[model samples]
Target: MGTHYEGDLRVALLDAAVLALGETGVDGLSLRGVARRIGVSHAAPAHHFGDKVGLLTAVAARGFELFTEHLAEALSGGEADPVAQLPLLTRAYSEFAENYPEHFDLMFRPASVRVEDPEYMRTSGIAFEALRAHLEECQRRGWRGEADSAALTSAAWALAHGIAVLRAHGSLARHYSDPTLDAVEDIAVSLLF
Candidate 1:
């Protein structure tokens, strides 16, 4: 008898892809492997995603959606002060990276996924705007100096991204004496802002 999969195959495939990416990293993930892991035919992933890049693009899109939700929830749990919000947002970004390293990795690697996919574009924009809105408010209130809001937003994101990437890749622990990502993240954020 042939294997059967009920529910949404697309979602199942994405979940399998995320897990496979975690195990093999991006370079080793394949449509056949993802399908095989889920007991689906080898062509299932390609049918839904067109190719490996398409599957990765879908993964990146889902990552952005989850990422945006993470940021929104973090900001909403705190006071409205933009200055106060930075640490929360920074921590949330890093936490997302730590919690979803595979998604985080694929989300930032532009060359690995389709940049023009509508879902990916929309979700990623929402994630960026979450920080952009906060930075704009900070600039308006003179809380982040006189630098342009765009530059300030990008700088803040870059700082958080750098920390997250380093931690994800295990380089932070190798180079720094800090015993925890939180401690290093706090120090980095406090130093600049």
Candidate 2:
């Protein structure tokens, strides 16, 4: 029998999974690895999560929740103008990536793990909804162009995703010392406008 902790093992396993994923890519993540990291037997994770994919799905869901919360907080803060808000969002994203590098990797890696699990889809949808709401606010303030709102939103997401990916890969910092999310937002906004 697997040892039980005082709190929820599922949550603990998910946390361990994120750490393992951050340290190693998705391909390197294993239930046994997470279990060992958490000081449990190899089969402990299987008790909490059926398989490796189950653990990954849980981690992905948690990642989306964290991402949504950070983005929402950024939008709520009035420290900057709309033009500046984009960069703040980008910065928040980059900060999240840096802080939770493992979650960041799993969150964006294409086809590395299945996200079809209901919990994963639901959490992912929440993140998308939060982004859409932010985009709607931008539209309300006349920050967008004649482009369709959905298209504009998609473009903004793509721009942010691209920059975040570059930043994560160390290409942006290595290639440009002055690289900042503001610089990226400026280029995106200028192109869109």
Model 1 per-residue lDDT tens digits across residues 98-132:
89988998899999999999999999999899889
Candidate 2 global CA lDDT score: 0.74
Span of 10 residues, lowest total lDDT, candidate 1: 179-188
Per model, how many backbone clashes are there?
A: 0, 1
**What is the C-alpha lDDT profile of model 2 across 1-193, one tens digit per residue?**
3465668777888888877766887888888888887677888888767888777767777888988887878668786556557766766776677677777777765475577778778888888877777777777787764558778777777877777788878788887675665565555545555
Cα deviation of 64 in candidate 2 (Å)? 0.6
- The numbered model that scores best in TM-score is 1
Residue 113 local lDDT, model 1: 95
Q: Give stretches of model 1 more than 4 Å off.
A: 1-4
